[model samples]
Target: MNGHSGNVFVLSAPSGTGKSTLAKRLVKDVPDLDFSISFTTRAPRAGETDGKDYFFVDDATFDRMIRTGGLVEWVEVYGHKYGTGKEWVSAHLAAGKDILLDIETQGARNVHGTLPDAVMIFLIPPSAEELSNRLRSRGRDPEAEIQVRLDYAKHELCEYPAYDYLVVNDTLDRAYRDLESIVLATRLRRERMGDTAQRILEGF
Candidate 1:
């Protein structure tokens, strides 16, 4: 049951679903929560710092990690590669720090395979039309790329049933509150509070 460790919260959503924004805000506003910065081969976008937003690397470095198994899971998307570090996740979880992992749906499933107790949260927009509108409003991708993302979102939304929680991002503030409540509820679960509960019983 991974007693005395920390909870791994896997947050996943389609591109332009505002998952990144929600993750950043949750880590910023919440206490004792760490963001698992992913490694990517993609070039830095505007205002994206090297170590903060992502650890930008070349294809060779990314391949090395894959070959050496330094990454827990990796995937290629839109011609760029992304991966999560194995050591970082292990060390943080051992230290009892709840970490938020923002990855794709497939990666989340892979993580669940190993960490069966990990909390999986799938975020979605109100509707498919709204998802397309959000993707188009970003202005980051062209018409074809946007269409590709929309098509993927439709497919990804179907996988939400596999997740532990489904959050509809109708409004940012409301969604944030939902995330906070989930964290609190998970923390207070009897399995996670084994030590604390035992101590209280001993006192009685």
Candidate 2:
């Protein structure tokens, strides 16, 4: 076993809160941090690569993975299944590489149960009105679907208190900075820095 394990950072937010964009940016800015690519039983959309965006699998394959314990957490959303691979996460953490999981609230909670050391951050819009506007701007969902998402967003907001940090994503640049800061701060925690501290003390 490795002497050290890296941190798992979970980012959760409502559908229209820009959490995905922020997560991508944070991974690009942070060194040695990788974004966890999820496996989904949904078809790839335009411009989305098979491995980059998600590992697209069929229902049978997804079910087989679940039965064999290959997935860490699996959830069905809008009739499609999405899950994180257990082996991939374990290997990275064992190698002392931090990982970023941009999943929904339920997935975050599930990961926390297994990896209790994970740092969960909740992102929210500046105002409910802004959230609604952002959702509408996507132009992909129908009116009814949009309403469903907005209602779900309200419920998601109530879970913010359970997160380690809450970031308001009113401005992209500011939100990215805040997210980056949280990752850096977690890395500098005493528990994570124990080996480095020991090495420094030995030199003195």
Structural similarity to truth (TM-score) of each candidate:
0.95, 0.95
lDDT of 2 by residue, 1-204 (tens): 125788899899999899888888888888999999999999999889999989999999999999999987888877899999999999999899999988878777787777788899999999999999999999978989999999999988898877999999989999999999999999888877888888899999
Inter-residue clash pairs, candidate 2:
none
**What does each candidate score in C-alpha RMSD?**
1.8, 1.7
* lDDT tens readout by residue for model 1, 1-204: 235788889999987778988999999998888999999999999999999999999999999999998997788877899889999999999998998999898788788766788899999998888888888888888999888888888888888988999999989899999998898899889888888878889999
How many pairs of residues in model 1 come into backbone collision? 0
**What does the lDDT read for residue 150 in candidate 2?**
92
Positional deviation of residue 95's Cα in model 1 after best superposition, in angstroms: 0.7
Candidate 1, RMSD to the unseen true structure: 1.8
